[model samples]
Target: MGHWSRGEIERAFRDYSHAVVEIGRSSDWSRYADLFTEDAVYLEHVYGEMHGRERIREWITATMSVFPGSEMPFYRRSGTPSTTTEAGSSGRFSTA
Candidate 1:
């Protein structure tokens, strides 16, 4: 693994947050696929595991189909990216 500088990590966080908000605002979960690399792997307890971006996109799109026209309201809590020096994850909150 390569070391990521603070700026790179912050930029990634901002971009990811933007993409997530876009998906929720548009109700097009497929766009979330763009956030991952072509060979990325996704694992979920309920959905099992998936490989590749397209597969993840398909799964998320299909699973999210149950909740149509749902808006995921995103909020930032606690630390901001600028102050974060280590790698971290972001989460989305949605009400279906």
Candidate 2:
């Protein structure tokens, strides 16, 4: 394990949450792509998984266009960035 303190973890969660919200507010799709890992796997119920940033960008663009307007705000259990390890990957997150 790493030598991360409680405070550090808390800060990380907070930062991640803020970053996610920022992505939703951003008009530039390229900037939104920066938040995700290059090879990140996007899990979904209907379309299943989408791997890599390129796919994610395409998906987001299409979706955003369809929706027209609105921000998809992601919140953690206590409004902090929380992971859904059991859902799939080790650091997988749930948008709740």
Best by TM-score: 1
Q: Which stretches of candidate 2 lie over 4 Å from their true place?
A: 1-3, 27-29, 78-96
Model 2: colliding residue pairs: none
Each model's RMSD to truth, in Å?
A: 6.6, 7.9
**Worst lDDT window (10 residues) for model 1?**
82-91
Stretches off by above 4 angstroms in model 1 are 1-3, 71-96
lDDT of 1 by residue, 53-89 (tens): 9999998888878775655456654675542222224
Candidate 1 has an lDDT of: 0.71
C-alpha displacement of 80 in model 1, angstroms?
4.6
State every prediction's TM-score relative to the real structure.
0.69, 0.64
lDDT of 2 by residue, 6-86 (tens): 779978776776666556556455566677899999886777899998888887777666765644545346434454112
- Candidate 2 is scored at a TM of 0.64
